[model samples]
Target: MKQSGNSLIEFLLVTVVILAVTASILALAGQTDKKRVNEELSDLATLTATAERALGMPQGHYEGLPGKLIDEKLVPAKMVDSAGHLQSRWGPVNLVPIDVGAKRLAGYSITYTNVPSPACPLLVKGGPKDKRSIRVDSVEVGSFGNINASALAQACSKATVSITFEHHLNEPGKRSL
Candidate 1:
């Protein structure tokens, strides 16, 4: 009886350790995935801003939607996927063109919504939370043109140019892991 009790306790101990280690590894993987997705989102935002600046530079005024600009060759096609959609690890990014009125161009803002995979665990907070969309309302686009500071300020005040991403969180491949 004494020997059987000891064997059972030992088995339980080993099982607990294995479970703990597996949990830690999965958590780490999730963190890494979140970081990668965030970086991709930032890159897309930067590219959009730069492309808009390029379009606005020649005319001393930047106006029109990103898609239109791309069609005009002002923005590169490489900036978006073959489907003409900007994509991140989380999913497709959509550009919401804020009309650049007769006013100057200020900065813009960004927001993201992620639909996590059922196969994966819940993501951590303060990054891209699972199944939730977060908006970074104010992203300032500085004066890329020769416009005056006052005009820039006015544009900033009234500008509605922004971007958003919404998609399912696809799982990384074995090589990525």
Candidate 2:
């Protein structure tokens, strides 16, 4: 009579195959996340610089103000990402209204935004104390390319790509909730 030794060997082989498949899946997932993180970092750098640069020039009540940095030259009306999310091609990364505390017409506040602001919140009114405050939405990068459309359009989308922004209020004491 044949022993059941063959059954044990078959079981070992199946286990090995399962482990290999699992390992492969985990590796792929990791690679994808890495790629996304890198992309988010790089993209954020570009957007932040661009937005900051735009803050340099003085703007009018209705007319758009100039940027602090114009790498490509001239503010664009809008900029679209690979997924079609847009930034103002010509305007600031994002816009904020004149605040009451502002020393000038507007103070561009890019420090608070770690990454570039999103394409939405067309206009953000400044705080009562500061006139020159523009709040660019935070940009988040996820492993997946399809960030929710609303998030892409709005700064608060909460994409996987997270950013920490820093800001120094011109009139912190005057700020209201």
Candidate 1's TM-score: 0.47
Candidate 2's displacement at residue 28, Å, is 2.5
lDDT by residue (tens digit), candidate 2, 1-177: 145788888889999999999999999976765554454344445554444444433332212322323334443323443433334322223333233344444333332232323322211211112222233344441111223334435654433222223222233443311
User: What's the TM-score of every candidate structure?
Assistant: 0.47, 0.42
How much is the lDDT of residue 126 in candidate 2? Answer: 16
Superposed model 1: Cα runs more than 4 Å off? 58-64, 68-79, 100-111, 115-177
Model 2 misses residue 124 by how many Å?
24
Query: Evaluated with lDDT, which candidate comes out highest?
Result: 1
Global lDDT of model 1: 0.42
Residue 9 displacement (Å), model 2? 1.6
Candidate 2: how large is its RMSD?
11.4
